[model samples]
Target: MTTPAVLLLIPASSYRTHDFLEAAHALDLEVQVGTDQSQVLAEVVPDRTLVLDFFEAEIALAAIAELHSRHPLSVVLGVDDESVELAAQANQRLRIPHNSPTSVSLTRDKFWMRQCLAKAGLASPGFQRFSVASDPETLRDSIRYPCVLKPTFLAASQGVIRADAPGEFNTAFRSLQELLADPELQKRGGERAKWVLVEDYLPGLEVSLEGVLTDGCLQTLALFDKPDPLTGPTFAETLYVAPSRLPETVQQCVRKAVEQTAQALGLTTGPVHAEARVHQGKVWMLECAARTIGGLCSRMLAFSGGMSLEALILRHALGRDIQTAQTISNACGALMLPVPKDGTLHTIAGWDTVREISGVEAAVQSLPNGTAVRTLPHDARYLGFVLVREKTPAAVETTLREAWTQLQVEID
Candidate 1:
């Protein structure tokens, strides 16, 4: 059989995509990169490399269709959430294998996700959607105090805020509305002025599960324990430790919840990122996406044990064999570059000192110096990340704390 060429839709500079492409070449798969245009045939070029951006739906669909109509390959795949929908649309039109379109919509829409979970007997936080928050009185009655308000569609913790009381809710609502109306945000998606989700703030130990699903059956891959205290108004994820220290039963319960959610969402193929709260021995599903974890910050499975989640998902989406691709290993954790204050990043101190910590395997500063950063509801900036491999969880925690202390972020 001839080798199948794969097209990856991502920004050209994507470090994550580069990692996957390297792995694919090692497996003897050819790659092609382009904007989603239907005329770009992969089958014609047995060996090619292309990375396309499919953030815009119409353009992406046209490109994929153009390619499929000509190349007619064994597989076509996309990793971005925006492109996931496009892929599903193309799959139905092209008769290619992919996650169902219905599932994509449900998972991408945080509002719909809550409903789906509640209907399936899975625990979901109480939520309310606002096309207009005209009355503070009625809105206050609907949501529990100390709630979270955020855009229903955007990620990277953009537009997410906590409202501790009625007064805070009104202020946050207007502030978010204005932010959405800003020139840049308006260009991104704010012009539509769509609905926002206000939900009961969940206070518990937060953990994230990364999994792979094939033909709708889930194989639990990795569990990450959130090292930062997330019980608050601003849920900033600072640290992630894989192979969670949770007991066996709790782990099993979390896994079961994730699998059931996958089935409900019809996430049959590809990687799924699920966030849940382990509160009082009960696992509550908070959010899930049909894409791999973002920011390349949490490398629990791939960078952790050498099992490339991105590669496995791409191969699986294209209908390739992936059983041999996944492998688990020692506990892996990532600490997002700590945000010391809201200001421009002048310099980071104690880089050499953190390197001296025993478990730290890799440390890199992700942000450029002189970049102005601020606190969210607007800012989600980190200086760098520290990836560590340690013999025990305690050792890992101690090492992270020691490293965290030694490092100084000068935000002025």
Candidate 2:
């Protein structure tokens, strides 16, 4: 039997791509990565690699065409929002199985996502977009207090801000508009200067669901608990505990919501990352990412529930029998290293002290001691994360707090 050749849509350095390779190996599939750098592509090539210039749409299309000429490509997958669209376009061009371009667009644009979810009768916050030309005071009057504002395309809470009143809204909106109007940012978005989302704040606990979508069929892999209440003014996530402790009924509701979303959006394949807020005994779907969770949070799914969410995504994208093969074991949790304030990295103390804490298995600090850290005006400050493990949830939480308190991460 010939091994299936999988074409990945990202550079190899990305954590997502690395996890994909691991999952592909487990499924017995040979993988080939597609990237823009010819040099990097050369290093990974002839072992079934292809060079794709994702930055330039025309170039990506041409490159995929050439690869199609060489041999049949079965599965195409990518991680970032841009890469997701490229993957969809490549699949469509080749008449292969993948997500529809429309679905990819809907997932990429936050404004459109909210519209779609609301139209479908799914619970989503009321949101509107703003441009630099819009009068800040007038806009503020129309918006609810404690609303969210950020760019439409960007993620990771970059430039996201919260305004709790008319005065705060004016100040925040003016500043955000300035950022959007920056020459550098304008160039990145092809001179499209639009302020981000203005969302009616949802009061509740936020959680993210990691799952796989096969032929528009959504499979719930793991439900993650956001250790911090993400009631947005600054909606940056902190920690995640896997195998959510929510009641069975709520879990079922979340699963059904995600599945319905995938179907409504026509996401036929690949991984789906959905965020929702539980408010007053009801679940409201936030925007969904057509990829895996970001940053160190991916590790949460791994250690918390013994489920490798990213790996499962890779296997599904590589056209393997994921349903019959994947497995999970123990509960795990992860916390992201947060940026407290804009300052030079000074020193992190008590590293040795935390090592002495019980149930503290590993601590990975991504921020270096001299690196610059900055925080949003409304967001809570976070230094780094400490991972703890135990047999029971109570034990896990106890150990986590102990390690967190013991670690002295001082920034000056």
Candidate 2 regions off by >4 Å?
Answer: 11-13, 26-28, 36-53, 182-193, 302-307, 324-327, 349-361, 377-386, 410-412
The best candidate in terms of TM-score: 1
> lDDT at 123 for candidate 1?
83
Candidate 2 lDDT tens digits, 237-349: 76677668888899888888888887777787888989888887778887687888765456545522343666667656667667754334356666566665677768777
Q: Pick out the ten consecutive residues of candidate 1 with the lowest summed lDDT.
A: 35-44
Q: Judge candidate 1 against the unseen true structure and give its global Cα lDDT, from 0 to 1.
A: 0.71
lDDT string, candidate 1, 121-179, tens digits: 88877888887435555576667888988877666576788899888888778767766
